[model samples]
Every structure is written in C-alpha cells, then in structure tokens.
Target chain A: MADPLVIRGVSIDDTFAEAFPMRGARIILTAVNARWARIAAHTMTGFATSVIGCKCEAAIERELGPEDTPDGRPGVSVLFFTPDSASLQQRLIERVGQTILTCPTTACFDGLPDAPERMPVGKALRVFGDGYQSSKVFGGTRYWRIPVMEGEFLIQEDMGKVKGIGGGNFLILAETAEVALAAAEAAVEAMAGMPGVILPFPGGIVRSGSKVGAKRYKTMIASTNDAYAPTLRPITTSDLPDGVNSVQEIVLDGLDAPSISAAMRAGIDAACRLGVIRITAGNYGGKLGPHHFYLRQIMGQPTA
Target chain B: MTDRITITFDTLPSGGEGLELDGITPDRLLTLSNAEIAKLPVWMGRRSVPLGDIAAIQGELSAHLRFEGDLARAEGVGAGMASGVLDVTGSVGDGAGVAMRGGSLRIGGSAGMRLGAALPGASRGMLGGEIVVTGSVGAEAGAYARRGLIVVRGDVGDSAARGLIAGTLVVFGRVGADAGTGNKRGSIVVLGSTAVPPTYRFACVYRPTVLRVLFGYLRRAYSIPVADRFVAGRWKRYCGDISELGKGELLTWAEA
Candidate 1:
C-alpha cells in the first residue's frame, strides 16, 4: 500500500469500499405517539441485518415530526434493502403487514413518494381488512384505511422503489480490541442521523467480517476474512500490519454511492482517534461491485 | 404573452334560459387567442351567439384564469375540465364544473343550482377535481360525484351530495334537508346541522383519520379556514341512505 496517507497521525490506506447495487424503499411509520412509532419501526427492522440469511436489510433512518408526515403525526422513517426489486417489495409488504399493522395507532406511508417505480405494499396488505378496507386519494396519491381492532390503520397504496447501493464497508485496524471498539463506537456516533445512509450492523460495527466464498467449505457463500483476523495472523497471509491486533468493519447501505462515501468519510474521520493504527476499506480488487468508495479521496486527501 | 386568461362580461342579463359556456375551459382556452375565444359559439336562449357579443375576453389562457361576470344563468361554465386553475370572480350558474376530470374551480360568489352536479341523465359528475365555493350554493351541489372534493365555505341548498358514489364534499356552513339522500358510497361532511333523512342511522361519534389529513390539506392548499376544532373535534357519523347501497356517510361536526 504505497505509503498510506495520514489523517491526524493515523495512516489512511489507499483502498476502496466495494458496493453492490441493491433495490430498496423508504417507508414512513407513524402513530399516535413517537414511542409506538419507534416500537413498530424497531420490530419491523429486527433480524433484518444481512440479505444473506435475513432476506433483507433494513434500519430506522430518522424520526419525523408531525408536520413532516402526511397524516400529521409522529413518524419514523425506515429503509429496506434487498437484492432485487421484487424481493424488496415482498419483504416490505411482509414486514409492514406483520409489524406496523399490528401495532396500536400506527400508520404507514410512503417515504419516497416522488420515485417513479412503485410497489403495491399497502395494496397487498389491504386484503387483511377483509373487504371492509377503504382507500382515499389526496394530492394524487391513494391511501388505504383498514379497520383494525384498535382503530383504523392507514397506509399508502404504494411505496416507491429506489435503486440503492449496499455492502459499502471500511475496516478499522487497531492495536487492541479496546481501541477498535472505542473507535468503532466513535465512528457510529459520528455517522448517526446522516440522511440517505444507514449502518446496518449491530451498533454500527461488525466483528466477524466476511470474505466472498469460503476456503474449506465450498458450499458456503461467504467466510471469515482470515486476513484481518488477529488469531489467524500467523497462519494466513495476514493483511494486518505489525502491531495491528484487532480489526472491526463498518458496513453501510445507502440510497446512492455518494451517500455512502459521505458517511464513510465522517465515520473514518471519527475513527482516526489515538491508538488507531490505520483506516482501510474492503474491496474485491474492484470486481465485485459497481460503486468504489476510495478511502483517501473520500477523506479529501490529495491523491498520489 | 399573457400568463393567464381572463374573460369578463361584467353583468349579463339575469334569468336567461341557458347561456352555456361548457366548451370554454382553462385547457381549451389556452390553445385559442383572444379573438378566437371571442368567436367561440355559446347558446343564448334560442339563438347561438359568438362569445364576443356578451363577454370581453383578454389575455391568453395559461396556468391561472379568471372569469368576471354575473353568470348565474350560465350553464356548464367549466364542464369536463381536465386541468389548470379557473377562478370565477363572480357567481356562476348550474353545472359550473359538471363532469370535470381534474384541476381546480374556485367561485368567489354564490352559485346557482346543480353546482358540480352530473348532466341531465349522466351517471357520474365531477370525476376528479376540486371545487371551492366561497358563497352559498343552490340545490344538488356535488350530486352523483364519482371522485373528487368540493369545499363550500357558505350554506348549501337542498340535496347536497345526493347519491354520491365515492368522493368527499365538505360544507363549512349549514346544509339543507336530504343531504346524501341516496348516496351509494361517499362522504358528505357538514359543519352544522342538516335535515337527516330517516333512511340514515347514527353510527358513531368519533374522529376520522382521513378528515384530519383532508382538513390539513384544505387549510394549506386552498387556504380554507378549517378550524382546529374541526380537525381535532369529534364527528357524528351517520351512515346512509340505507334505502340505497347503504355505504355512504354524512358526518356532522358534533357541537357537543
């Protein structure tokens, strides 16, 4: 790595985060209060970490005020990411039907109302009302009102589909696990609340970073990145330089490449605290995905 | 080039039989010049006269429009209109926005009978659009509407929203008797009392989620004076006319 550039005494590697295109959607979940809205959002986004097993990736984007919502209520914006448009739509319908509809005084709306492509998520869920559901159109958008036990659950007839970029990641190399954890936490705190980007991993940090395809298990699609594993430093052609004993990855999924790059810049800047050996990113030699988020360029450092 | 269209007749003789201007719409007027619009044919009693004989037209029709005249005898002022803004500076006659598909029609003064009602034998009226009347309206306003909204700031005549299929009619003032008489499915919302048809039954007195949304929209979009009480207040929903399909509703703003 040609003499990495340093940001605040920390070396920034000349690497890039590879991101693949994923279909996603933004949905608004509103309720009588913010608490219930949050509960519905959290319940809906639970277990939706990775597309490999969970079939989708989702997280809460932000909390919206009453004036920001269509129904003038407290709302939470949630984003769902999947490999394709069809799966993304199906996952949204399934999750919204089960969680948001079941929640008390909760209503769902389309966050990406201007997007051209639409998925009939609320339309599909309207059948649960058993023919008693009614729809109303305002400002050219249709909203379905389904009568539930608690009250009426209102949802938009369709949610917009957006072409998004997922799997944008950067690996933070540190001298110890404590430094790594501290740096990851700092990064997460910095990247929180940034629009158009979401840190899908737990607490915005991933301990078990995976590499494409396994070494021994041929059937497995992904395996641990042994190169960055401190335990396998001696056994593998370890990418961890000397004194780098621990590594943590920050995985981001965003609506666009620029969003991911912007978040990564903020995150990497925060992670450049003391004891941080270096900041690098994960990529498959520029072959895996279409979007390449260069570390140094994102940090606004001059190129060599 | 003028950015808007304005047709002014100042004062036409009242109680004329059927002075029709149904062909004159914002979208249609935009494609014609002042002279061309002036030459457009309009029925005046038994004789068809060019529009210039009565009204003085000015400006090219663009995004917004203005109609200044006493046209209480006029018929179908903006019928089948699909787009653009047509603001009637004075009172209009029957079928002001008959069978309109889209766009907005705002009337500054009281309107005559059949305001936004279907044609003589048509099944539906005012398919998709918005109508805001600042003054009172005569009988059968928003009758047989398929889908759209009508917000009348003043009192309404009898049979408002009668047989409404599916849409919303919000009357901020008093409504005459037999509102939503045989409505199959739709909403007739009144702020004050209305002569309830016996065929209708009281359902519940609760706040509807859609009303809050629609009221907010009306307050913001059209600057309609939708009070906070109406937005936050309870409404007495009376489902009627059970004598028909029994899906329509008349929601009176509960004073208590």
Candidate 2:
C-alpha cells in the first residue's frame, strides 16, 4: 500500500506531518453547571483568535464533568498558547482576569499538570480586588480566592506551560451542505470533550478558508482559499471534483501530536458516510506548522 | 534575578510624611526591558515616580531581585510585583510585599501589619513567591499567602500566618495569638510556644527533615543564624485548620 491513503478517490498525502514547539497552558474554568462553564470558557478564549494578532491563541479544549473538576463542579478546560512563556503568562492573566473572574462560580486550574515550566497567571490577576482576596492550597496546588460582590472567585497560583502543537486540521467535501454540515457536526461531536483536543471554531467548522497570503494585499498574511471554494471553480484553480458541491473543514489544536492525530482519525471515520464525497487536509506545503497528519496512514487500508 | 524592589517604611517620624522605599527591587526590574521598567509605578511620599526615578538599577536580564533598606513607612512596596524578590533591610510599613508572587523576598527586619497579606479586595496573598523575614512581623503576616514560603524569625503580632494555603512558613520566634486561623495546607513551624487555635489538633511530636533544609537555606542565603536546637529539636505536629482542608499542619518546637 502507498504511504498516503487515497479514500473515495481523494489523495491521502503520504508525507510525514511535521509539528512545532509552542508554549501552551490549559485553564480549567469551573462554574455552577455546564452553562456557566461554557460562559467562562468562551470569555476566556475570546479575543484569542491568533497569536499574530492577539498575541495568543486559545480555545475550549474540552468539557469536564463535576468529577473531572477540582471543585466538583461542571467545568471547561481551555487550551491557551503563545510563542513564549512570558507572553503566555501575561495573556493568561489578561484573559482569565477578564473572563473567569467575572463569571459566576468559576474556578480556574492549570490543565497541564506535568509540565515543568510554570507560568504565573492568577499571581498577576489577584490585584483586581486590591486586598480582600484569600487563597487555599489543595492537593499540592495553590488556588487564589478573589472576593467579588457575588461571592468568591478561585484561580490557580501557577499554571503549567508546555510545548504543544497547533493547527491540525482536515477537510470534508460532500454533495450538499447538509452532508458537509452533518459530517462536520458528527466529527465535532465525536471529538467534543476529548482530552487535550479543542475545536477552535464556531461549531468546529471553518467556512472561510485561506491560502498563504492575499493575492493583492502584500501585508495580508492570509486570504480566502478560493481554489477550494466551489463558487470560484470557474475562475480559480478549484480542487473540487465533478460531484463535490460543498465543503467544510475541522481545525484541531492539541497539547501533543498524537492527540490531534487520534481525534482526526475518529472525526474522519465518522465523517466518511453517505453524501460525503471526499476528505482532505490543509497545510503550508509542509513548511509552516511543524505537525503534519497524512490521512491514509492514520486509517488502516484494506488489503489488496 | 528578580527586579522588583521591596521598600519598607522605617518610621513615620510622628509628623514626617510616610517613608517610602522604592529602590530595592531585584527581579521585576531585571527582567523588564528598559522601556518596560520605565513604566512601572513606584511611590515617593504620596506622589508617583517611575522606577528609574529613585534607584540606580544594576544586573543583567533577570526576573528576580532583593531590596535592602529601612522601609517602615514605605507603602505598596512590591504592591503589584508580578514575579520577583523584595528583601527589606529594616521594618516595613503596612501592606509590605502585598500581592506579590513568582519570586522570593527576604526581609531582614520586622514587617509592619499585613505582611504578605491580601490586597484590600483580593482574596489571596503573595500568590507564588517566598517571603522570609528575619525579625518579628506585625499582625497578619502571611495572611492569605497562597502558594509560597513566608518565614518570620522573631515574635509576631496577633493573627500571624492566617488563611494560608499550601505554603510553608517557618517562625523561629513565638507566633502571636490566633495563628493559622483559617489555614488550609500551610506548614507553620513555631520555635516558641504557641497557643493552638481550636482548628488545630496535635498530630505527633517528631523532627521534620524539611526544617534542616530550611535552616540551611536561611543560613546560606540570608545569613540568619540557625540555632541547632530549633533545627534539630523535636517538633510537636498539630494537624489543624481542618476547618478548611484538614491538610495543613503546625509544627511547634517541643520543650527541649
């Protein structure tokens, strides 16, 4: 069998995917229930779209149960990454202070427990209240309690920062929007709540894809991937086949390489149902992101 | 390696303006680029001055520092120090080392009230740094110290080391009344007899190995004399502040 798997007439590139080292920290936001957890995660991960513009990139890694949380409440784990440790700490302090501290019943914890590098997040955010905050140490971790009018807000003293991989993705091409969306949804649902993997987009789908740079704007680093847009098929170098009409992509970020690959495998298999014309991926010709996930090798091929 | 300066108010001088110690941070100043350091707000009397206004800075790029001065009236020293060291040479004023973390501090003299205590509305104190005071400390020393070390060598005022969590504090002197009031996982070592709060229970009477390490560090780093009796003596372990986590322990030296 060839190294890259070709499924449904689509090429599963055989090249070994490359990944890079990035500073990442997981923030666990515990709220009263799933609703509050979502709120805190959304706010904490907001304005953190890309490291280029926002100085950090973050998303909800997964939803955790009451048993999975430190405080025995429903929570969400957010993965935040930056280029360096100092930037990571500063960004975390800004984001968590604005997001989790203001949210009701939200308590933040470090998700990367084993990483030796520790960044002080709550250590900086504790000054919002000036002098009324308290602290508690449980299970070898110190948590800060910032008093608010509603009650108390708890945050971990130091968050573990580790080298993580970002920008892992796959594409789903289907005959109709329904099929594309369904497949994307299925993929997201399957990967949802999985440890260390986060779908950073709304509903885990990216519709406005991009190429390396804008065609006209020299300063724009990226623009639309018109080559893949079904509408631009007539004028652009459309990669769509004869029957494919719609496409949606799933972008994943993880604490490690294997996690992204595993989640991709699960998501791709679930998306390979009826009306799904093909599956592919997005990469910078294997130049930008250090991690690469070739499709065919991830899924076992049927013997000839 | 820390650039944060720790200024203690040596005295109010009855009618004089409150003393300010703004020149002795070691960490925050080191790590910050010159431009960054120029922006940090330090106080002189009631007016605000850039960090460059007072102290002459030295050292290469670093994120930790030490302060050596009499700071009895210096308020807000290390007030918003994110991560650094602030060693004080003399007694500090109220709110010394307030809201500090990610580094350490060694205070040679006494700290005024609220040493390592939380900021006005903050619930945590000295989030992730070490605060070592060789002399007696005022009330609420190490109050709400979240996850670091706070060492006081002399007698403390009331409510010393209260609301501590997961940090280690060693008091070579007698701890004041109401020590460890709401502590969670902090280990307080009192060299003198201390009245155990109702929340603490006597766990055992044994010598801890960590004390030797602590004493060694004190002697080497701060030049504080480590008495052999206290370092090698048996300690009465009282596992208390259970009202919080039941994880914190108080190790008071037993009568030799």
> TM per model?
0.95, 0.56
Superposed model 2: Cα runs more than 4 Å off: A1-20, A47-49, A52-54, A134-140, A301-304, B1-256
Q: B138-236 in candidate 1: lDDT tens per residue?
A: 999999998988889999999888889887788988999878878887888888667778988898887777777888788878888888788877888
DockQ of each: 0.56, 0.02
Q: What C-alpha lDDT, on a 0 to 100 scale, does residue A2 get in candidate 1?
A: 48
- Worst 10 contiguous positions by lDDT, candidate 1 chain B: B9-18
- Model 1, residue pairs in steric clash: none
Q: Which ten residues in a row have the lowest lDDT in candidate 2 chain B?
A: B2-11
Candidate 2 C-alpha lDDT tens digits along A1-304: 5444555544444444344566788887877779989988888887776665678878887789866766556888889878776888888888787777888767788878888988888888888767655454433466666657665577778999888886777888889889889989998888877778777777788887677778889999888888789988899888888878898988777788878888988888878778887787887787777667777666765322
Measured with C-alpha atoms, the lDDT of residue A50 in candidate 1 is: 93
